[model samples]
Target: MISTRDLTGLPDVSSLRRLLQSLAMLDAILSPDWQYRYYSFNCHWAFGEEWGSMRNGSGDEFYALFNQHGCFLKGFAHEALMTPCRDNPPKLWPGLFSNVPPEFSECLNEPAFDIASTTFCIWRYHDGREWQLDDLKFPAGSDPDGSGDLLSILDGTPETYYVWAEEYYQEAWNDTSGLTRDAVAAVYRHQPLSNELVSAINSNLRLEDLADDLRDIGYPNQKKPA
Candidate 1:
């Protein structure tokens, strides 16, 4: 695992931002390939976070807590609390999950859905060692997208493993606390007033539809919510 720490506060944050900016300038001048430049820039940020938090020892080191969606918690390591998100794509966070290993393709059972470009693995914790997606996380969520098999997908994978990391990103976007019912209806265009679904939404319930909020956001899907 590529480990790093989270640096919070204005001074550290500003320093990190400036450093990233400088790296970007260097990349533009030195590297011809933008992909390689971006990759190098991400590595620098990841390592800088680690070096900034050197006070605590290794076991209690204040590492950066990155959610499956690439949203990072500042100055604290909280990997245990991250929830798995399979439906949303991982590539949403460009450099964070940009490179996936070729070994991942070996785990596919349904060869069709396991497209070479689209598929990727999120991080997971097992007994003691870190296992690959093919060896660990993919078995559960392997079937077609909406087979009502989400729970099953999680079952076979290491305790809380999911296919992609962006599920956490969707969670952040669906915040409805400040908005009124009318406001939410205008944004969603779906029935926001239905008592049951609204109640579920109010209770912070996570169903397939809410979890996979990206599904119908762009286009109409004929299939019902599973």
Candidate 2:
């Protein structure tokens, strides 16, 4: 287990605030009354493989395996999934993958996986509708279950997340100078699955003035932690 003690000097108020905003976003994206599940996969050393097992999905299917892998590769896979598919209206593209293998494409072609990894929170939006991994769709013949394709990138815990998070923060800070942007973006970049919370915070918050508030709070530059 990574000791909180080791994480002490990293960014305090800004990062914590971002963390709170993230959780709050989770609440918003997923209505409070909605049934939700959380799991982690990838580098077990960092997030712990046990985290993924805690969720309700059956490991017997490809989407289930894909979602688990997606969570572990959240930093990349989720972002990829979020990118809109230009060719298919309403259907989203998974992201920029180099040479997507045939096996993975096969799984996607048949809609074998309905929910993308980040899309698992759909359960929150659909009451009485349980989120199952099998509901997700992959390109035909795609091996959405391929172990080597993604896990290869998430071998180190937090390293991938941190790199993604850091770049995310820098971009948010540069685009809009303020506390809220930094806080919100920090969480969004790491765990975008928490969409509800982000929407709530953003509903009343303005990216333009966040920095000023952070400055008033004695946090220099109204920026979120790097």
Kindly list the per-residue Cα lDDT of model 2 for residues 66-142, writing each as its tens digit: 32222211111332333233235544434323233342343333332443333221111112122212233444333
Q: Note the residue pairs that clash in candidate 1.
A: 5-64, 140-153, 141-153
Give candidate 2 regions above 4 Å deviation: 1-20, 23-121, 124-137, 141-160, 168-226
Score each candidate by Cα lDDT.
0.25, 0.29
The candidate that wins on lDDT is 2
Residue 80 displacement in candidate 1 (angstroms): 11
| lDDT at 177, model 2 | 22
- C-alpha root-mean-square deviation, candidate 1: 20.9
Error of 1 at 49 (Å): 22
**Model 1 spans with C-alpha error above 4 angstroms:** 1-11, 39-226
